[model samples]
Target: MLRLASLKFGRLFRYGKLLFAASLLVVMLLNTHSLFSSFQRNELTDRRFLSLNKCPACFGSSWCRKFMNGQLSFEGWGRLRLLDFFNVKNVHFAQYGEPREGSRRVVLKRLGSNHELSELDQRICKRATGRPRCDLVQAMYKTDFARLNGDVRLLTPDVVEGWSDLVHCPSQRLLDRLVRRYAETKDSGSFLLRNLKDTERMQLLLTLAFNPEPLVLQSFPSDEGWPFAKYLGACGRMVAVNYVGEELWSYFNAPWEKRVDLAWQLMEIAEQLTNNDFEFALYLLDVSFDNFAVGPRDGKVIIVDAENVLVADKKN
Candidate 1:
């Protein structure tokens, strides 16, 4: 009986050792994979920066030049940390301008996740060339801007009828107003179009159609009393805006009076946006605490995320 018990005990010990080894191996493999992924991501980001610098149709040319030249810098992309794997949005933080010129912290956003951007590219390619595998530059050159403009006009009236996926507005008058304002301000749009290749111009316009945040910011600039983040500039798909403050979600636990004030401010903003003297009524379709922030000094509510805003032509 003693010998049998010893044999069983010896078997159990060996099994436990094997399990421990297997668990350790899994952990090591996971770490190795994570490290490799981080390296790949960094490499990819570097490549994108290089491409942006070389592209003629760069958005916010001055800002892009500064970023590529190291006047503006950010932490290199690496996702080795477990928490980083959950960051689905292509957003980053960086310091803008030179220290001597009053550098400020800014938030950079790609306006969409990697997956979403990839899908957009595919759609654009297919529409331009009838094939998802076509060259993006060549496809852009082939895209008919006149046709796109016509579609934009048609979609404008559809916004009120709930048929448009572009800007939520009836009549193209609001879009025209924004474009005129942007052009009058001598913003990057005019410079970008001047002597630009048809391919580059098409690329720029298509990107705007996909995401109108740039247009919105330029038209309703924070300096002009718009309760939106101050636009710094953009490079390729990424846009830079001044970091307003911590998200409104972070202020939920503040004093009751402070919370009440914030609530009142938000309601006032809503009313102003809907009933402003302007010909258009701007409606925020997706409202969440995460999309707004309180000014660090003024405590004013600002819309940090202006992606899903809808502009409706009140006259129409």
Candidate 2:
């Protein structure tokens, strides 16, 4: 009886040992799986960052710069629309008369796109139920510059648009004179007015709001052929094109979510612009805006004179 009891106890002990070994092996496998999963996630994040931070210039190539440098400027009503948001729609380019350097002077006036309205269109707009200035042509070309110097009699939309026709379609001599003045003054108040358009302000505001982590994927500017290539964020892209057309839409495969992101970013930038808190605004203006791009990474809708997008505190 004692021998049988001894054998049974030994068997029970052996079985318990086997069970313990199996549990330990399972625990080790689970730990290994968890570790591998964490490693994979980290690797993916690092790759994303690297791509975002890559230099745009390194990728833009020489051909791209050629494409962007020679785009045609807007004309006529298109030019008026371009100047409207900044309240400079009434600005008319006129010649000051015979001068030592040139013949004509560039002046600001109020003008609408439809200044060429047929007599019927003008008559219908006149009868419309708004202020006397509510003519369709007037509404289209009118801008508020009351803050600058109050409305000048010469600032009517009709006058301004008419001026555009003369200025844009100027005789070679007139155009040459205006160009000389612009060259001399560098388009400051003497040439281009100090006023900024609303869209421009909005772009600056968005740039200021951006504060990405110091990861590789954060956007930064690059050294492209143009001077404006250096202000991109890590995820920023630079696309050089001569014309402002639908090409911007082609680059991103038209992702709806991406478009929404771009819009949100622009609004954020605009808010910062109005407030003029420009830690990042200057950089964006110098690169993104000057090239006339709307968003950071290869955006369309470029805003000219972006270098002027400095904070009041930082203005030199």
Against the true structure, whose TM-score is highest? 1
RMSD list, candidates in order: 7.8, 25.9
Residue-level lDDT tens digits of model 1 in 134-215: 6665555555432343224222333233322336444566645544544212343332233333433444455455666766
Every candidate's lDDT:
0.63, 0.30
Model 2 TM-score, all chains together? 0.19
lDDT of prediction 1:
0.63
Consecutive 10-residue window with the lowest summed lDDT within model 1: 150-159
Superposed by TM-score, candidate 1 places the C-alpha of residue 236 at a distance from the truth, in angstroms, of 1.2
List the candidates' TM-scores in order: 0.73, 0.19
